[model samples]
Target: MSSSTPNKVPSSPPASPFKLALCQTPVTLDKEENIAVARDYLMRAAAAGASLAVLPECFNCPYDTACFREYAEELPAVGFKPTEDHSSPSLKMLRQTAQETKMFIVGGSVPEIANDGNIYNSSLSVSPDGTVVAKHRKAHLFDIDVPGGIRFKESDVLSPGGSATAFFAPEIDCTVGVGICYDVRFPELAMLQARELGAKVLVFPGAFNMTTGPAHWELLLRGRALDNQVFVAACSPSRSEGGDGYTAWGHSMVVDPWGTVLASADEKPALVVTTIDLGRLDTVRKSIPTSQQRREDIYRLQSVP
Candidate 1:
């Protein structure tokens, strides 16, 4: 007999109709406290019967350039185990919690120190069995100057990631695409993930400021969902008096393929839970078949990788 274990068996994903949990918690400066709070929120989500859980970006450190270096830690190479030499309390917690809860976790984003010695804003997708399934570095850095409103440049310290992250989560029975904050602004990433990578749902662990949050947050989420004909979810840290005057918009939401807002939350630390129906996604696609109507003669989206 073959030596593959039960967990390694290649069986079809369990029948769908799963629940998703969005943890819109607060980000604190203390690394240990931040990790503890995240762990608690994840456990709470698991208790609520959610198979998939998402966290907000910068959930461990302040959203500031000066703090990235201090908070940055080496990460496990893609699917490998964490290195004992480096400090990775956040990653360890994610793995432990996923194993304990038997839930797939999209670990928002964290500051990472790569071998190149450059710090990157990165997100990890962990399987229910605590395996590091995928890693997504923020491809497009947030570099903007809104005149009198806000002037924050991520290019000042953080380096941009060069690849797209789309992976299948057998536990959740769906393919998920990950993007951090400003990566949502560029439609190419979303389209590529959903259209090319066969991602049924796209999750953006973003933190939009007051200026952009109220204006374009919902609009962008809805637009991406409608155009891609896929479920979309955005998780953000709650509004708080953060240091350096950085205020998050704090409205975490989940949208259906039909561009309908299924669930959303106000500017507070809350666990937003919603049930995502894969059956309805199929119904929506059948009702409006846009994928087959694309004109390859006129235009086409190619995947370099």
Candidate 2:
């Protein structure tokens, strides 16, 4: 792997000093087509020496709320076999592909049908050996009424995830935090990953709309990185079609501990790959001591209402 020079373009330098890939692509209503695209991107990312690859939220189905009920699926059993045209092909294939690639895979977030029959926006992190190492249900669902008259009431059809989840990826030599699309807007979740779970890198597979993506996507990502002093990777869908003209802002990105945009893909169907220097995390943390400098004692002194 070649060393990544600062602010350069179109060059595959070494394995990012520490490397990860964000698979940013557009999805239509076709689940099989999305699976095929996901498989191809995983191949591309693995070939590029990325130890981890992240896809967008609800990659297997359209981002519309109505689609969840029809598209949601049960978690596959151990050694569960899926038919060629399985209704939920991406989840099955993702587990299989991670083992096949021998790389840690963050399978983004998908709409899953829980045993209770409630649909959930879930994210899965698989080990190289095909084990489901970590799973995060999106704690914060996207329930908003945009100014454009577009509305998304995730609770209408999907149940919210109750806890934060992170997993250790031996490839990166640290615990990795996980989040979904709307979760990026909540800093406490990121803090739970970094402060509570001691995650060195935080991954959020998002599909923010043009309404909020431009304004909050990068800002939320950089703020998490800067405040937490950890690497942040934001993956987004390239398109959306539902709920009164919703459009996704598709600039998937990787930010370093210093909040620098190491690599970012344009608003199109593409992949953003970058290296994270593990050493840089230590250096930044040592210099700023932001994580260590927090005064919980002082905050506790605030008068209780």
Candidate 3:
């Protein structure tokens, strides 16, 4: 897909059919530099005519346990009010960039300092007006100890978020669900968004290491897309060589409602732009009718309050 200038004028009612961009960019040790790179990519995505752009998890800082505290900053209060100190560079830049580019931006997961002094892995969805439309903290902490394999625990430093998050995007005229890295492992989150909230797309800004990425990244994405019949988009950081810290499995991709990979990026820094056709979503759902076929009488999934 080609990049095009963003539409400046807002439609009284959002138009149907829009492009989505998955920015699989490289992360660096430098926080400010990472923010700059994210801004540049957003510009490129907007130029590509993407009505919405998504960043990978922890785009502004190194994804390490020790680095979380060092890089963590106070995010805007839950109501989208700016923090008094305005300490979070990532949040500030994201709001500004969304407004300037006039595009809905899924600001990827960041290490956020909550009011209670606990740190959380949080993501924010910003509107073209720069207002925060949705906020989600990672509900599932990535804590696994595979013997002879990678064992890292986010619960040691981060707090799990409480509720499922899905927000309506006026530009795309669809609801989008937000999730972090480990949250993708839980199908209930995506299910709730699709079944209850009527989300057409579930966006997960994840960072899967070499160990799990190759094994489960694509599998989980396809499963979610197929199960819910909703578009699934996962954005990951560009894979880097051996470093002192974690090595992400890059391969950012977008899967259509039919569980097909519409576009994918290799283990390199790049912008993946794809047009998400809602018409196709309807066609698939109508043909399959899985939503109607579900035997809710036999078994029902409950939601957490």
lDDT of 2 by residue, 30-62 (tens): 888887888788888888888888988878777
Ordered from best to worst TM-score, the candidate numbers read 1, 3, 2
The list of candidate 3 runs beyond 4 A from truth reads 1-15, 78-85
Every model's Cα RMSD, please?
A: 4.4, 7.7, 5.3
Better of 1 and 2 by lDDT: 1
Q: What's the lDDT of the predicted structure labeled candidate 3? A: 0.85
Q: 19 in model 1: Cα distance from truth in Å? A: 0.8
The pairs that clash in candidate 3 are: 3-47, 3-48, 4-47, 4-48, 4-49
Residues 200-221, candidate 3: write the lDDT tens digits: 8899999999899989999999
lDDT of 1 by residue, 87-115 (tens): 58888999889989999899999999999
Against the reference, the lDDT scores of all candidates come to 0.85, 0.77, 0.85
